[model samples]
Target: MKLNYKEDWPLYLIVLGVITMIAKEAVEVVLTPSKKMTSETNKNEWHQPSLYLDNELKGADREMVLYGENLIANTSYYFGPHGTIQPITNGMNCQNCHLQAGARAWGNNYDAVFATYPKLRDRSGKLETIASRVNDCFERSLNGKAIDTSSKEMQAIVAYITWLGHTVKKGDKPPGSGITQLPYLNRAADPGKGAVVYAEKCQTCHGNHGEGVAEGSGYGYTYPPLWGDHSYNTGAGLFRISRFAGYIKDNMPFNQASHQSPALTDEEAWDVAAFVNSQPRPVKDISHDWPDISKKPVDHPFGPYADGFSEQEHKYGPFQPIADARKVK
Candidate 1:
């Protein structure tokens, strides 16, 4: 059959396009590795590892893991003022900060803890063991004394964290290992603006004064406090406005938000963080912190910095200037 070249051109082009697409896909399949291998290469990709206890662990190890999970989920029950084990920490569970016993993606999960500990940390300016790191949280975040490293509770917690990150290679930080790093705002975060946002969005769960709702039993908080004696101390990591802002940007207003669909804008997050941290909380003697003042984070919120910036500027920042200065140095 004699086909008219001009009239039949559209049909020929459509057929050629379809074949090209098929060929391209075929070539890609041949050239690219499988999904698993690609995921291994890009370790940051979300691979929601199951919390279900694996068949690999047996007997005492299994018991320890379960206990650790319980401890993380209900830390206040064992360490609060009315604790059955030891009345040490303010009545807030570890899960309040770590989220889902440190399993939730970008909710400050311990996905990289096992893989990355025994590494140098700028906060203390020392190579810290996982046990030392855990103790740091106890002292600062929980506003409590450090549990003995040899204690069963400490060992169990380490075991659980290790179990969570067992699959990840050493020094590899999986995506969503910690809170999302929100970008620095150009202007200083305003506490006044944040107060409004808190009243509208956060007050119901966290209370008007940031005193979280107490659990019915009065042992722990159902919603952890953001400030005051009961909350994380001034030396805590979240005391840093940037860390708190990043955390809030990724997860806040309870279950209404997530990293994939954050409820607040970067500006709102930063402002809210500023407001929250500006409120009074427990004061830790951080005289020993950041042995090398030059290595101190721009957002550390304390004085005696290598830079001439005031503590106010450090706490509620247009932080890029500090960052830029550091780069120049």
Candidate 2:
């Protein structure tokens, strides 16, 4: 009866092994399906393609400064009805608050701002969308009421901001401490030639002397005085020819029809801006975000909104280039 104990032990061991295998299989059967389902669900989630990723998107790689310049040039969006939604300070447009596509001395730069959205804001006390951020500008910055979240004005501003975001590398912090770069003549600029272009292309609205037109029917200065006591101060922005040129190239004239009425070449815009700034205007010390003129950039009208050069670089040339220009000759 006690014989063959080893053979019986082998059979018992085989049974134990089979039970362990069955238990392991049971645990997998309970857990595997849910994990696979989760993996599948994750794969099914949708993601929108970034506009910057599109090679065909016009101005994808355009500099933020250039885009800001263009937005200034094509500024009709800020002034027209539905643009600001309310008149906070002196019947101003978004441009008045932003001061040239948000490129003014103390104004906030709209570019690369979207990257921070869906963020928790203390003021709102909750997560906000990029649209909410634009609305906030309308209420707080512009001192105006909020526009409908889905309205055209909101959309246009969004588009402009979106364009700005594209100029910066996604997920990267925006460069420069602030808009410290000074405006410089593009390689294509010819100021002398720009004068003739100014006379022919700009005089009608801006006046031969760059005096702004009257308000009201003409929509408050049919042409904003390029340089004058009432005009944007020397530090306010209109002082830079390249910045002016960029704005005129995109959005000049109160009406979109007028903006599209006669298209301007970048060279022509540069020329006209130069011609206008070359004219005499009362210089005033306007309050600026960066009080240290030495620290400011020439190309960036707004304190921290512009890019493309260093603070030292902005101060050495652009505005002070008068002396350098003499040396070149």
Name the top TM-score candidate. Answer: 1
Q: What do the candidate models score in CA lDDT, each in turn? A: 0.88, 0.50
Runs with alpha carbons beyond 4 Å of true place in candidate 2? 1-191, 217-219, 253-262, 286-295, 298-329
Mind giving the per-residue lDDT tens digits that candidate 2 earns over 156-180?
6666666555545544434321132
Task: Write candidate 1's Cα lDDT for 81-139 as tens digits.
Answer: 88888899988888999999988888889888989988999878789998899888888
Clashing pairs in 1: 44-175
Clash total of candidate 1: 1
Backbone clash pairs in model 2 (N, Cα, C under 3 Å; residues 3+ apart or in different chains), count: 17
Q: TM-scores, in order shown?
A: 0.86, 0.38
What lDDT score is found at residue 79 in candidate 2? Answer: 38
